[model samples]
Target: MRLTRGGKQNAKGAGQEMGGPDKEKLVPPAEGTAVPNGEETAVPKAAEPGPVTEEDRTRSEEGKSAGEGGQEETALAQEDGQRRPDESSLRSQLEAVQAELKSALDQAKEFEERAASLQAERDEWAEKAKIAYEQFLRARSDLDGFRKRTERDLEDRINRGKADLILALLEVLDNFDRALEAAQKTGSAQAEGVQGAYASADSSASGQALQSFIRGVQMIRRQFFETLAREGVEEIPSPVGKPMDPSLHDAVAAQEGGGEHGTVVAELRKGYLYKGMVLRPTRVKVIR
Candidate 1:
């Protein structure tokens, strides 16, 4: 090892003082040997560390900070990598739940629409049923009224027929009463004549009374015929001297006569026609 500049100068001075021949050249101390100052030395002081500068100290501090920052960044990156798949799975599950909720809402709306349609149909059918019931009630009422009217009309017709029959019989009773009055007058005149006992006068008065009775009978007959005509009854024409008609004449006897055969000789009973139909045929004698 080489000695320091200061150590070399000291050795040169010592050598000169010792009266050595090589005074200009100085020998270095051996490694780890004792120097003349009683201090052990291994190498020259020139090989020792130099004084630290501000720039160097600053650079060392910056390097240590950069290393610590790099380690922290690496740890954060590893933690992020480990959590990525869990975040993706959570997002997917949330989307699926949203889709299911949307579908359920759609189904509920459809069901509400169907229920509204069914309610409308039910109301329409109820209206139709109400109309049908009203129609049935009206029809029943009309039928009942018709039946009542028919019965009333039938009863009225029967009552009118009975009235007509009674009227006809009353006409006959009136005529009979008139006939009885005339007969009573004739009997009273005959009794007076018989009580007086005058033969000639009695005969004349009796003839006059008989003629009056005959006139009354003829008047009654004419009045009866008028009543029958008013009731739509008419006498058939006399069949005497006419050909016998089986529809109008009923032959009661036959006689040999100067007239043609099958001819009516005399009418025994009067025939009547009511409304152009035969009510009674005439009883007649026909010529054989």
Candidate 2:
């Protein structure tokens, strides 16, 4: 058999020319230029220069960021400088406002305290005035009571004096009546004639003459009796043939021709009372 040159061969018998190209010796293309069919070529570009390695790219980015950061920091510093004085002015104004508010609160507290003190003083004065007024009213009431008591005492004294005078006058009248009765019983001609003459005269003329003669005495007696009557003086019940009451009557002696043991034959003297109080008891003759 005839063997060709391109025939499959064993690894041990293969020549050095049969191996693949060396990858380690291969070259890359130059900047901005395309490689030819099988050869690498280099070309320059007009754009900005690119980083040659990883470390060069990182350093270029850091420089660009640092420049931008420096410009921003300058602007922020200017803005802060502009606002600092205004902030200080605002803080000063706030402090002044707080001081004014504190002063106003203090003044208000002082006014409230003064008002409370005034109100307390007014209440105290009102209480004192009320007490004084009550005292004045009590004094007036006491004065009125004293005046009434004094008036009552004076009236009682006057009444007692008038009652006593009236009693004396009544006794005198009783005696005169007895004298007249005795004269009537004696009845002598001369005495009868004199009595008749006295009776026949005009009663008005004789009464006027008698009243004139005893003017002073009668006037005193009449006034005394009127005063006693005004003071509630009164005569006790007395009539002919009435039964005698031991409580109101003074028995002088036993009488004849009476109906029973308690019979009142005659009244010797009248009884009197002042305001339900017995002034004098009736003197009488009672049948046994």
Q: TM-scores for all candidates?
A: 0.36, 0.51
Q: Among all windows of ten consecutive residues in candidate 2, which has the lowest summed lDDT?
A: 3-12
Which tens-of-lDDT digit does each residue in 1-288 have in candidate 1? Answer: 333444455555555556543422334766776587874444423222334445545655666677788888888888877778788898899899999999998998998999999999999999999999999999999989999999989966864674467456555745665666677777667666666546577577786777677678767777866876786677789988889999999999999877899999887766777657676678899999
- RMSD to the true structure for each prediction, in A, is 16.5, 15.0
Model 2 agreement with the true structure over 1-288: per-residue lDDT tens digits: 122222222221333234432223434765776566867544333222222444444555676678799989999999999999999999999999999999999999999999999999999999999999999999999999999988889877886786687678668756555554454344333344446445655654555554454554555556655766786877788844778877788888786664877788888887888788777888888887
lDDT of 1 at 223: 85
Indicate which candidate wins on TM-score: 2
Model 1 weakest 10-residue run by lDDT: 44-53
> Highest lDDT: which candidate?
1
Return the clash pairs for model 2, or none: 30-42
| Model 2 root-mean-square deviation | 15.0
